[model samples]
Target: MPSDSDPRTDTTVVAAPTPVSAERILEAAHRLGLRYFVDDEGDVGIPWRCVVVHVIFQDTRAVQLRGTWHRIADTEHLAALRSLVEDWNATRIGPKAFLTVGDGGIVRLHGEITYPLDAGMTDAQIDDFVFTGCRLIVALVREAEEVFPDSLRGSLEP
Candidate 1:
């Protein structure tokens, strides 16, 4: 039973379940196979290459993911990595990289996935964020290895 004015009257439509609270978001994180630490305030911290995401709780119904890469402490290494990151950002396909050169001459690079989850996210939607973020991290680590052949030496650490 559908009315002519109903948007779903012409095609099959299934609404996505929204993930709004800390518990549901944590569940989605588990489904993504990622180890997450949720604090008393309902913030989420999950590991990523070079960066860590602090999924800050907004209202009871929303959150925002912010990631900051680890800083390279050596001045020479920092400069070298910055050059490499700049080159890769110009060529590689993914979210645009953001960076900072802070005190102690450290260089840090970070990237964010553009998942529109204002209301929250479905499990599938959460997967989109997790998968895309991991891929981008891999790409960055590969490019960084090329920049510091000796320092980067082996694969990403556990």
Candidate 2:
């Protein structure tokens, strides 16, 4: 017979899931020792050098980590940039990567990863998501630098 104190007889206590919020995301970033700032619109953002990752809370019960690369590419490199974005989207389990062409045909790179939080998450999960999201987007930017050596304008350094 198994006693109450037996290892197999111990009751398991489950903690409630933590609801996702911008505050929770910021708290996780803080615990990771990352520097963050609130935008003029009150959104929380983490800057990785020239890349800024925004922690966005959605009304649909989701949290998104969106990052924008600071470098702008000339339209002359559009084909190569498109190929890179396509290959990344096709081969990677993202942080989906893409390019945005602005006025005067200038191109910019961006990446984003979203997590559904309808059922909520644990503190560990939130921290992991924040860290992973930031790292993945930064990786995308680095890969772009490798693909186009001197084409991207602006410094990636702080």
Candidate 3:
């Protein structure tokens, strides 16, 4: 899924398949101050692993300041920052290989969410900067007998 040592994607924690619940996960995310970012079709970006829904929060985390949500973050949180960059890079340049969890089991690289980036943006600034840019990529693993189910079971794995 990766060619060359693109620093943005290197050494990133592989998105793993974790069994979890969606509603509770989303509630926790909101507690962290993440808002719902809906796509044109109105589907929110939620992460699930192998037929289980995990984190149900905005793919982008925005910070509220001065009567507006501004993209910002501390410089120390680079690991999480890199993941966002890699995800964005995969979307704009070409296909991305993500560790996907589905009913068929956990697999890497099938489909990816694409987007763009700005120069010299740090994780702190990225929160609000990325808020409006991401495409909603909800994860749903195929059930052995069902395609996709409404409302998954278990807690989200962050």
Give the best candidate by lDDT. 2
Overall lDDT per candidate, in order of appearance: 0.61, 0.84, 0.31
Query: 2 or 3, which is superior by TM-score?
Result: 2
Summarize candidate 3's per-residue lDDT along 1-158 as a digit string, tens digits. Answer: 21245488685543332222233334434554655444575334432333211122234331211110011223333344346446545555422323334443322223232322222233333332233222222221121113223322223231
TM-score of each: 0.63, 0.84, 0.20
Candidate 2: stretches off by over 4 Å: 1-12, 153-158
Sorted on TM-score, best first, the list reads: 2, 1, 3
Q: Residues 76-100, candidate 1, lDDT per residue (tens digit)?
A: 5655666776787798776456667
lDDT over C-alpha atoms for residue 73 of model 3: 28
Tens-digit lDDT track for model 2 on 18-133?
Answer: 68887888899999999999989889999987699998878857888999887787777778899999999999999899899887777888999999988887877888899999
lDDT of model 1, residue 21? 60
